[model samples]
Structure formats: structure tokens, C-alpha cells
Target: MADITTTELRQRLQAGETPHLIDVREPWENEEASIPTAQNIPLGSLPEKLDDLDAWKDEEVIVHCKSGSRSSQAKAYLTQQGFSNVRNLLGGFTEYSAG
Candidate 1:
């Protein structure tokens, strides 16, 4: 799937659509600023947490990080692991919070 812009995500949430969002930043980074509904699973821990995300395998799972880099990696990993609908948040939280 193509990456989603923060604006698009904001619009979806404003429209009352609840999408599954994953924040792949560090615990400290997540604590600093985070979307309450987004689950924080630090990038390094993703391997161990694969089972926790199997439920969302075929679902639209949005992954993000401080910038777009880490989430990009997360998206790639998830996609290779059989997740068909994973999307990286364009610009990550940096863009999301900017708006």
C-alpha cells in the first residue's frame, strides 16, 4: 500500500474512522508524544511481538516513528512477514504533529 499522509490520517480520524496505528519508536519517544490509540512497539521488539500483531495481519496497520525511517523499516518487515495491508505514515509523527 502507498504511504498515508498525516493529513489523510487526521481526516480519517476526524471522520470517526478508527484505524489500527502502530508507533515503532522507542518507549521514551512514545512517552514524549503519542496518539493515545496507537500501540507503541519499539522497532527492536517487533520480532518478539509478531504474534501480538497477527490479528492485524490482513487488516490495515499503520506504522510510524519519529521520522519516516524507522517506520519504513517496520513496514518492510511487516510486509515480508505476510502482512498484506501495512502502511507507513509519511513523515511519521514529525508530520502528524506538525499539522
Candidate 2:
């Protein structure tokens, strides 16, 4: 899997590139602090949500969590499930928000 830094993501957003973003944090965590455009799909539910993401099979998808741990697992899992363009947001939302 590959990694996407917050700077790169921010630049993309500024450039009007609406890439698919999945927040792999829990509902509570997402509600507390989130990228408004990111879709909420907790890590635990990813297994059952594969079909829901079928449309993004060949699309670029960025996954993030509070930190990077959960999203790393999500990226690995998605790649195994035939997602060719999945990336883990380095340092996740924590670093994204900090900067």
C-alpha cells in the first residue's frame, strides 16, 4: 500500500480534486472531529462494507483514522479485496488537524 501525507491531501482539496475519503474511525470519533467530506465507515465494519465500496474498486481511495494504525489495516484489507488504488493517510487526522 502507499501513503498520502496531509499536505498532499490538502493540496488536492485546494485544487478541487474530490478523491474518495473514508474515515476508519468510530462514529463517535468521527462526530467529534472529522473532515466534513469524508465518509464514515469504522474499521470494524469494513469487512461487511466491501460491497458498499464496490464502486470505488478501481478508484483512488484515501483512508484515515485518528492516528495511522487503523487506516493502515484498512488500506491493507482493501488492497487484498481488489482495491488497486488505496492509500493510508500518514499520521491520519491527528497530524492533519495539527498542521
Best by TM-score: 1
In order of appearance, the predictions have TM-scores of 0.97, 0.96
Candidate 1 regions off by >4 Å?
none
| Tens digit per residue, CA lDDT, model 1, 26-83 | 9999999997589999999999999998999989999999899999999999999999
Worst 10 residues of 1 by lDDT: 29-38
- Write down the lDDT of every candidate, Cα atoms only: 0.94, 0.94
After superposition, which runs of candidate 2 have C-alpha atoms over 4 Å from their true positions?
none
Tens digits of lDDT, candidate 2, 4-89? 99999998998998999999999999999998589999999999999999999999999999999999999999999999999999
Candidate 2, residue 58: lDDT: 95
- Assess candidate 1 and give its lDDT: 0.94
